[model samples]
Target: MFENLKILRRAVKAVATKDPELRVQRFYLIQEPQVEFLDRSTHYMNVGFWDGDATTLDTAGEALARKLGEAAELRAGDTVLDAGFGYGDQDFLWLREREVGRITGLNITPHHVEAARARAEAEGVTDRLDFQLGSALSTSFEPESFDRVVALESAFHFHPRSAFFREAYRVLRPGGVLAVADIIPIDGATPRMAFKAGPLSFLKFSLPDENWHDGSTYAKELTEAGFADVTVESIREKVYEPWRQYMAGRVDDDEYRRKLGKALHKGVVRHWSGQDVMRQELDLLDYVIAVARKPE
Candidate 1:
């Protein structure tokens, strides 16, 4: 009962602390004039996760969604799992568009859970999908389940990616495939440095994850985790180049983007030196995808 009460309090606090308008402004992706997330004055957020109370998404959020879906090889009737479910937009959107049968979504954030639930109900996929408040390191589901599991753009926020890989492998049935997608570092990402900037900041300041390395080393980890047919392939078409273009496309010209980028960098430096340090650095894993299969 005490645990349940604590859970309820956290949920209530998550919803009550910020107004919906503020959330939509910084994190929601509906940017048309008629929609809530359209205003341009909002501070930068990476595709809707709040960083320093800011609300914003890259201009290529929609395009990136399509690319992510394609990379996951989504198909109809696939029993899927979405790890690190964000606002639930990508999973919800992909499942519905692809007519996937059953999808279970898990994330650490209460705000993400609530939003994902609301959006699923709104989209009328609530019956086919289930949203749970959980973590990638440990999920609340039976083992040897799910046809495909995707950790799109959210895996790097998980520490020791090996744990998640093990969990994913455990929950996947023979012949089931697991795909991990996220902004990974090519190299030079120490546990300490990982604690500093980019997506890791969200985990450190607000959530979990203090050790996030790029998937370059994850292939060995996955192999050691007992998965077969393990391959760490780069989906360059879907990740960095597109992301750079998408975020860059929001402004009118190069000059405007440069100005905004500098301003955003200045704010990061003021609030988070870790993020400030990464302002112009490009990572080989600015976008990457890894696919492995549980032995059939």
Candidate 2:
């Protein structure tokens, strides 16, 4: 009962707060129930990149991280700065698969920082992966410190994403790359729909108005931030619809029902299956993988 009240209070604060980072932080803090229901195995908080052979939730999330690595042209012996590193899943993937030299992760959420640090220690990769409680918008890293900067499914909450872009440019080496897997409102999403109050009204709190831009504008932002070779490629087809289908299937499963707990299962089935609100909300979003580079 008290926990429910706490979530209610946090939700109200998230809706009312003008600070984008705080709003997003509160949203994530209140999303434990939703997160558990969505991904049962992994700590991946992304809307998975679904494609051939990436059917399950965990595999699809990993595939999304790998896709970002490919976009960044991540190479061995390159140092990486993972901004908004949720659970440090992508950092682990890059260290093991891509053989990146080292990764330093920055995140605003203390819970994520603690959890990721624990995971890093348990996995015996603390030397290569460091998770710190910090903001991507204004990092403390030195200029030209890293070879690559990446944000996986987390840049949208960066208040004004342009600030992070400029910071990325500042902290990256002369020839470093900046890669991002981000979600933004489509060009067709007008002010009304973007700020509409309804099932997905939480988006109004989580996504800043400045971040509601199309691909072209996104590329322009990167260019303005002193990045060259900017490319923002849409991959919405493989992210949203397939994820909705997978969630629909999972909500219908008895095993998932047991796993999600009774209250969350009922709520998810109600809003997700009975009303189809999730699909309606997703239709208005566009997912893109953006790649850019600092000139040598």
Candidate 3:
């Protein structure tokens, strides 16, 4: 009961606060460094891209990263800026799989930076992976510094996300691509969804009101930020529904229960275990991969 009250207090404070960055950082601080469901040493923080026998959380997470990397057209000699990179798992994947020349990851959360840096050192890839404490919305990069900029599952927390778009536009070299795997509200969702998602999704997840919009508006924001050849595609079928099913299945699994341990007592865990409830909550969202390029 005390823990639940503490969680409720934090949720109320997050809702009342205007500092989105701080809210987002605090939101992530509460999450386990190793996501409870993943059951792997590698930590990934996203709704996985479920497709083609990618049944595990880690594999689907890698698939989503690969999808974003493909959208960015990652080349062998590219300098990439990963904005709001969580734990740098995708950076490691891209470095080895995509063979990107270098990756500079910027994140606001200190623990994430520390954890990612420790992982980089452990993997002996410190030279290629750079994780720094910074803000994506207001980076300090010079003009035309990177060949690609990507944000995986983290853009929605960026307050006034358009500022980050402008920042991405400014930092990328001419003709360079920008890609993001983002979550936005489904247009015309029912009021019950609106009410539930408002505090749970928006407040607890640090989603700002400005970031709540459909895919068309998302593309328009990139276009307005001086990106051309923009594409915002909804891949919800591959993202949300499958993820909910997987997680709902996990609720009854022994391994998952062992991992979560005492967290099972949390009200949120009970809420998540109900498949219909999870479906309704997830149905309110649209998962999209948005890609655009700076004009040459």
Task: Count the clashes in each prediction.
Answer: 2, 0, 0
Better of 1 and 3 by lDDT: 3
- Model 3 RMSD to the real structure? 2.6
lDDT accuracy of residue 259 in candidate 2 = 68
Per-residue lDDT of 1-296 in model 2, one digit per residue for the tens?
45445656777887787776777778877756454536556778898999897888898999999999999888998999999998888899999999999999999888889999999999999999999998999987899999999999999888789999999999999999999999887873556244442345666668777888888899999999999998999999999888877877887899777866777666656545543656766777789999999999
Return the TM-score for candidate 3, rounded to 2 decimals: 0.90
Residue 134 local lDDT, model 2: 86
lDDT over C-alpha atoms for residue 73 of model 2: 86
TM-score of each: 0.66, 0.92, 0.90
Extract clashing residue pairs from model 1: 26-55, 26-56
In terms of lDDT, the poorest run of 10 residues in model 2 is 190-199
The CA lDDT at 287 in model 1 is: 52
Whole-model Cα lDDT of every candidate shown, in order: 0.59, 0.84, 0.81
TM-score, cand. 1: 0.66
lDDT of 3 by residue, 191-292 (tens): 422445322455334776688788888999999999999999889999988877776676677766676556534554655644665577777778899999
Which segments of model 1 are wrong by more than 4 Å?
1-59, 189-214, 236-238, 241-280, 283-285
The per-prediction CA RMSD against the true structure, in angstroms, equals 9.6, 2.3, 2.6
